[model samples]
Target: MQALKHILYFADGEFGPTQAFRRAVALAREHGARLTLMDVTIESGIGADLVKRFGLADDVQQSEQRLWALTHLAEDWVQGQPARLRVTIGTPFIEVIQAVLRDGHDLVIKPVRERPSSRGLFASTDMHLLRKCPCPVWVDREPEHAAPRQPAQPTDANADPRCIRVLAAVDATQPDSRQLNRTILDTAGAVAGRDDAALDVVHAWQAPFDGSLPGAGPVDHDVQLADVLGLLEREHAAALTALTADYRTRLNGGDTHLARGEPAATILAHADALASDLIVLATLSRPREPGLFIGTTAEDVLQGAQTSVLALKPEGFVSPVS
Candidate 1:
């Protein structure tokens, strides 16, 4: 929720100005944040001796070429916007994270790299960033059609020029979910405010009644089960309301959804129905030690999500990388 101070845009060797790049530029201009354009290339597979014997140029040429291309690409896309361009050589995700650590970048924005057909929307690098990046990571999906440009209006200074819808997914039932829930709401609110977009919050639960019923016969058991279900639903509803009380005014119609089902399924189904442009959710389930994988709910949602995602890690999360 804090104002972004430095944003790193990973230019993934795409030819033109991607939506993610434009978003990074706009956010920088809006928040007066520093913007850095970066790209990563793999280390050379050919050994130095072989290159020297063959009298071939070293892998440094590759880096030089990438830097040149990135510079020219920025000149075309930046359109007088100020930004620094750098090309790092190593594993893509590791280099990106190292850049964040070295430069104190607060947010990393990049276009979603799609795998081959039938695989998934996000590539492995995207998943690594989501799982490991210390700072917030925004993976933007490009629209199928070119978005029509809307003329800038003379509005409040803080108002965002773009119109987009954002969904915030949270868990309210567990004691450990409070911090992450609050974080989801705050980050979603900040994005909605920045884009002047509608925001919706979603929480999922399951019925408390187990198996058949308790005492008596089938009829009494049914009644007891219904009562138990109602109580549990109410408790969940209250918890969701309390978690989102601070964001009531920011929502469209003060909308909040408390549904009974699996968490990932409910969240994804609601997001699809709402046609959300972006989802703000936590990647970790609880406070975990360093080097742990993300929670199951988060992994399932990410795997199934059709829209862009802004993934956040819990406090004290440390990356396994470096």
Candidate 2:
């Protein structure tokens, strides 16, 4: 949640220099943060003899070529914005996370992989970074087309397809989620402020029960269940209010929503209703030992999301890779 001092922009393969890369440059310019553009080349599976026979570039040569290509690809976008270029040979996600660990990067920004089918939301590397990256990871949705830009002005509906609206989902009722909720809000606020966007906050709660009570008839059981649900709603509302008290000015009056339903479904519905350009959420909410963890709700939201996502791990999160 601290100011982003160092940003790592991962432009793996041919998906580089897109909206996400431009976004990284803009952020670095705004925050005076150091930016690094990186790429990874997976080693070929061919035998050494066959590789030599084919006159293919060795690993060192491949890395050097990748580095040059990355630098050239970013030249127009970076425009001498003071960014470092790097290329490593390995698995993409592992190399990216290791770079973050090695260089103390505070944020990882990358474009979402293009999918052949819409059944799966994130690719394997995207999921790996979301689940195991130590720093905050932003997977930007690939834009269908470029929008016309106005000189030195904030994005608006007339100019950009994105609504410039941000949806922040928080889990406020649980003790373990309080810190993560704060982090989510802080990060959301920063994005909204930077982009001159509107921020809306949502919390979803559920009250589960069977139809019939142990010693009650249908009517009585229904009445009791209704009362229990009402109480649960009140409790959830109170908790959400308390959690967002410090952010009252940032939220104003009309930006908070409390709903009763499944967490993932509710959050996605709320985001769609608001036409949010971005969703700020905690990838892992529950308390767990230091390792890779992504909550069920987070996974569902990510899979169902139609907009870009910024996911953060908990305070003590540790990557499983090295």
Please give the RMSD of candidate 1 to the true structure: 3.9
lDDT: which candidate is best? 1
Q: RMSD in Å for candidate 2, one decimal? A: 3.4
For residue 47, give model 2's deviation from the true position in Å. 2.1
Which residue pairs show backbone clashes in model 2? none
Q: Write down the TM-score of every candidate.
A: 0.87, 0.89
State the displacement of the C-alpha of residue 36, model 1, in Å, after optimal TM-score superposition.
1.1
| lDDT for each residue of candidate 1 in 1-322, tens digit (9 for 90 to 100) | 7788999999776645667877777788777888899988787788989998998766687778888887776665454357888888889999999999999999999989987745347888999999889889999888877654333322322222253789999988877779878888999998888677899999999765455665658668778777788888999999988898889889964379999998899999998898889999999967686557698889988887778999998887777777
Residues 41-153, candidate 2: write the lDDT tens digits. Answer: 89876677977899988777788888887777665455445689888888999999999999999999898885565655577898889888989999888666766333332
lDDT of all predictions: 0.81, 0.80
What lDDT is obtained when candidate 1 is compared to the true structure?
A: 0.81
Q: Model 1: residues >4 Å from true position, as ranges?
A: 47-58, 79-81, 117-119, 147-163, 208-219
